[model samples]
Target: MKIIVTYDVKQILTEESRASYLDEWQKEHASLLRECDHLQFEMKRLQKKRPSDQKWIADQFDKEIRTRSERMSFLDFKMDQLDQLTLGAEIHDGEIQSIQEVQMGDEWHGREQKGKIVVKDGIVQSIVPDSKGKDIMI
Candidate 1:
């Protein structure tokens, strides 16, 4: 008797199983939120100082506050994107004739030979040349 088994790559890469990634990003987002709060508080305190002192320090505080505020907004946007993000996948048409025909530790080839897809944190980061060093167009 011959038996064939298939693995669903998509099912294996779903978001539920990848919650740790989101958790990590959330921690960074929280830190940014704290930094933003601190910057705002410092700006408010600077506003109540003597006019001469404020003149000397307000410009620096304003610049720092704006930079941190922008960074916080970007972090929030990134967290939102992560919440809606999905892993990419590609389905190739190929087949293994039989278990006996399959070689152990052999590279699997699709219809066309191409570069490898780099995946990091469930995201398609980049694609570089394969062993043959052939460029694969996206």
Candidate 2:
């Protein structure tokens, strides 16, 4: 039988990758800001068009706008942390999923532990096991 597993991906910060990350983050931040502006404009227009339901409409728009605002703040925090990372430092990139085969009495964690995958310059570098001497069944 086979089972799907998820593993962590670690990225080694370099000048090239750092710049790329910054650019991507900045673009996302700008997009979210623009979305908020558009939503605010729509909220105003709706309120003016329907004064009787103005409060309800405004509340609905505020909820969505609040969600986006929170996300933007989180992005800013991430960008700041990225800026503070030293070159060559490993950072948690994301995760990857893989399928593995297993049999009866198989030690799942020992044999197929979801370890860390190291990357540099957008390329895979190495895979590290969580336990020493335990090989990852990649």
Candidate 3:
């Protein structure tokens, strides 16, 4: 039998990764800013044509603008955080799923071992504690 297991992916930050992240975030920020500007322009044009619906239209636009503003703030914080990360520091990238073989009587769950993948410079550095997930028999 085989079962699926989840393992954490960790990245060893380097100058290359940092620059990549900053560049990506900058592009996203610019796109978001452009969207906000377009929304503002549309809102103004709509309110000018329909004075009676101005308040409702403004409220809807304001809601969307506020949401984007909050996201931009968060992106700023993320960019700042990325800038502060030191080279060779490990950070959690995300998770991946793996398949593991198991026997009928095997205790396949509740193991207290680290299932992790360490990567550096876009290459797999190591599979921690082996693919069996660092488990031990009691």
Per-residue lDDT of model 1, residues 31-73, tens digit only: 8778767877887687776666876677777787678778767
Alpha carbon lDDT at 83, candidate 2: 87
What lDDT tens digits, residue by residue, belong to model 2 across residues 87-122?
A: 999988899887777789876555455667888897
In angstroms, the error of model 3 at 61 is 1.3
For each candidate in turn, the TM-score is 0.46, 0.87, 0.81
The CA lDDT of each predicted structure is 0.53, 0.85, 0.83
lDDT at 56, model 2: 99
The lowest-lDDT stretch of 10 consecutive residues in candidate 3 is 129-138
For 9-42, candidate 3 gives per-residue lDDT tens digits of 8888999888877898899999889999999999
Model 3 whole-model lDDT (C-alpha atoms):
0.83
Q: Which order, best to worst by lDDT?
A: 2, 3, 1
Highest TM-score against the true fold, candidate: 2
How many angstroms is residue 107 displaced in model 2 relative to the true structure, after the best TM-score fit? 4.9
